[model samples]
Target: MSDRIMLFLLGFFTLTLTILSISASEDAVKPNSNDPVSFLCHEGEFFIKTRRNHSEANRGRPGEWKTACENEVLELDCGEDKTVRIIDVEYGRSDGTTCHRYPHFFMSCSSSEAYHKVHQRCDNKERCTIVANTDEFGDPCPGIIKYLKVKHRCEPVEPDTLKQVVICENDSKTLKCPKGTYLMIAEAFYGRADKSTCPHPKIKDTNCSAKNVMDIVGAKCDQKEQCELTASNSWFRNPCKGTHKYLMVDYQCIVDDLGYAAACENGNMEIVCKNSSVINVVRAEYGRGHPFVCNNSPTPIKPKGCSSPNEIAIVYGRCQGKSRCVIPATNEVFGDPCKGTAKYLELDYFCGEIWDPEDSPGAPIIKDVTKSTVTFTSEKLNKTTSSEYKTQMKGADEKDWSDVLDGKAFDLGKELSIGGLDPNDQLDIRVVKKKEDLSSCIPFARFRTKS
Candidate 1:
């Protein structure tokens, strides 16, 4: 009976060890073998097939959970047959805490290929939707939505000091700031604002001419608030009257009583004729002479007058009837007596010799005869004593030799009038007696006939 009890005890001990081993295996499997929360999928839904019965409790430590799920809880080699779908997305739990079970949609997927394939299909088809929970339907997946809030994109904001802002109203249209305002911010978006905001001021109506016009010395002005017209500004008036005449003296133009005439320089004077009248006078001829009155007849003649360097002379002479007139020799012939014959004869005859015959010869006779004939000859008075002298005769009829007859032989004197006899038909001759002096025994003669 004791042997039988020992064998039974061994069997009991074996059973106990087997029960412990089974319990341990059950503990390991049971901790991880809860069916993963069922994730439903539809056509084109992005999802991942959970490893069968994977549980959060099977995750070892915070970091060891990955190793625990290798090939079993976490699928490293997923076949095409096992599939899952992402029919919902839970961003936050009901208590407003971050959902730690699946921090992101990617944590629910085992394979990146499955996740990317599902996402691509859903993005193309626009059929995928996300549910916050099993009971609440959530927003569609951003990839599948036609219009999406693009992540990380922000609306532009402008500073408060910006005077103008622009906004895009549609795809092509944009709003702009008003006139008189500059763009400080340029084109940008304001949160929820539809139009552009601009800074503007109220413009007061004022005259531009009031600020432009100034005071000038000779300017003519008119009464007006705004001066835009051409006639409204300062202008120059017509200062001249009548038919205006201009005389250019220098560069300036001056107005005068005779209209517009220029001022004159040094000796120049401008004479403006008024009323169509004229002053005419002949100009005097220029020369150095006494001007005589011109004769008024058809043949004009100039009067006898002396010119610059000469004096006029006048004389009177007596005339006989077509015959030569002779005046008797008297004291009256010597220029009315008191002036004397010598002075009168000196003035008239200029030291010339004159004749006054005492009587007329029966034939041609010499008058005023100082000497009549001169004989020239050479002779030898003695063999050794030769001398020379000239002899003179009183008249042709008288043969009286002069004082030189000392038995000295005579020499001939030269005939002075070899050219022609004077109009008196007698010769007035001078004879030289010696080589030292001319002789005073010279003949002076004249002839007259009574018709």
Candidate 2:
């Protein structure tokens, strides 16, 4: 071949390869073709707090600022699958225009107890509303116009995902997850948040705290199946010289498998997974072995071992291999295993997947839902991945599945529309990642249309 022709061919192949590589990388983060839903392991990390502010608009003249009569109310909704976590709250006239009046125009101050008051009412709830009135929040600036600003985030309801580990000074403890899963630290503190943690006679300095504890522990423990942590001044560099220090850690287990669900007797229970995952029932029981579970009366079912014989088979048949399943926790379903026991249903299951931690995407959390439309958002706790999402709908009672959006694939966290539905119809909806085959695990959400 001619030298010029050889050079041209080499450059052409190199350019083609580069284009292909770029396309593949783009597809990994944002899949753009019609494909079967796939399962990605999403880290169960708590989201960063989002600020929601409510203030009174400026009215009247500049110096003659007239504050609105109505009190400012702050509302937060973290959706059905998550709970509200209050991060910070400020209530007072931070700005002049906000609830500004002639007497309080120049005052710019905030309440010292605003965070405590807001956290008491809204923390760990699905939805909350707080009023910024003198009755609720003491008038910090007296005649000054005031407003309310709350910063909070939503957290998943999976209690098993979070684990707390505490070690006294000079002691060591191991942080471990189940068989295949690894650990991810959510928070850490090397000082005393309270005096009772280590509980020593000389522990009078309860205000002692150390900074960067999370970074110190994360360097030794993140993404590991088991991590040994020691609580000592050598590692944390004691924040308070004379006070006893302890190490406290809040962590999560990153895993595609391991799930738990419970339902009161006679109530319906639902189990769901991502599109690429299937339900694998590990254990199921329908009884009040524990006094706290489904206890309607002061005392019900004292027997610890009361249970139905065929719980495993029944739950497996109903929930296995399907994206979503609902079963009633009634005597009819499991046969009166123990008569008049007032039993509840408890299920333990896992999704089958050994997924890469960095590539997994957290389940979609519904942000808003209406009669004909629903909006949801998904966050990648670690690294971002591109995956096409698809939705499927089924009537709560009827069988068979119907494709939503004409089986079209969309990006993660997009607002999806549900069309051709009758009013007051109960429905179950699930979102899955687009993949080549029909197997996955996805979270399920249920809603009813307005009549």
Candidate 3:
């Protein structure tokens, strides 16, 4: 062979060998798609296991809780079909024996920020890795041994199933469910939940959040197939003054059989369901979506968008969990939203098993009353740990409830005292417990101040 031919053949053989070696190395580290360790962690499954080695990391049953000691890495896998939702986390040793290698520093200590740190890294992720150490989360106790105890669940993420959307301040967004399904809101935040959402050049505070945003948005959108929202401070009063904020809504498309009915002005609309299935009101609108519907009257419908602000609450209060409900389409029930314009009552509902009336939290009970202060207590419904209570008050003749404490939510059963009130005043007070993202308020109670 000629010298040039020999050199070319040698180079070709070396390149082929190198390519084969690289391909083999890549295949060696690729994960098995069908491996049981790659499966998801489901709801209500609690398993406490140590993370020390690869085999130990994958050893526990799929539903067990996973823990990582300091300097150790914890892996959260929700598979390809689901995402992680951190329920709670503990960054310090709650008990003396958790990571008790150092007995002297095993005193119980916990960081108040463990949940937020873990959630920021793991929530809504298909796969994530977290380091349980001071670098990840600053040492809450310098001497105490700490571990990361995380409680999480895998939520399915199918097409058009679960969604997370962020609407910037002063902007609007419409959330809609797919055909044959209704909207179920999971989480709603009117204030900033994170630093990166709704970026601003001047506003940097991300720790502020609206107290009543869940209740406000839930009353408007829950059970509806579609809803529009604007993230303006006008709607949700500024939770943090001078800081730019946004609105975030996490929702799901729930599958259910829906029924619709409409009634023109000065008419009656009766909603009825099939055998044994009660009326679960999905949505109610006391206005016109289009000018063509109920066009029998000579009066003109000025704007295409007109709706009563309290339509859903009114309809839900009257018809929720009933086998048959009869409601009138009149200004008397739902106040006239747009006066002098023709309107109609449109409702969408589902036929399903009735929701237990007792499921709702009962009315607040007056614990103590004084001239300038009134204290009250309430019981939580569904044992929801994160549920909060908002109290309101109004004069005996007043028709609206004035928000107190800037619409802030207090922990359930915590005593709240309202001060700076006139003596001998007859006031009507009410309390509402917000369960997750649902807004239905419990019944109100009446109280009188001491003279």
lDDT of 2 by residue, 117-195 (tens): 5553554555556656755555555544577776667778686656788899999999988866766666678887787
TM-score of every model versus the real structure = 0.11, 0.27, 0.30
lDDT of 1 at 377: 25
Error of 1 at 435 (Å): 5.4
Ranking by lDDT: 3, 2, 1
* lDDT accuracy of residue 196 in candidate 2: 75
Q: Which sections of candidate 3 miss by over 4 Å?
A: 1-160, 258-326, 329-451
lDDT, candidate 2, equals 0.57
Clashing pairs in 3: 47-64, 47-65
Task: List the lowest-lDDT window of 10 residues for candidate 3.
Answer: 32-41
Model 1 ranges with Cα > 4 A deviation: 1-424, 434-451
For model 1, how does the per-residue alpha-carbon lDDT over 212-284 read when each residue is reduced to its tens digit? 1111100111111111112111221222221111110000011111111111111111222223322111011
Error of 3 at 43 (Å): 33
**Which candidate has the top score in lDDT?**
3
Please report the TM-score between candidate 3 and the true structure: 0.30
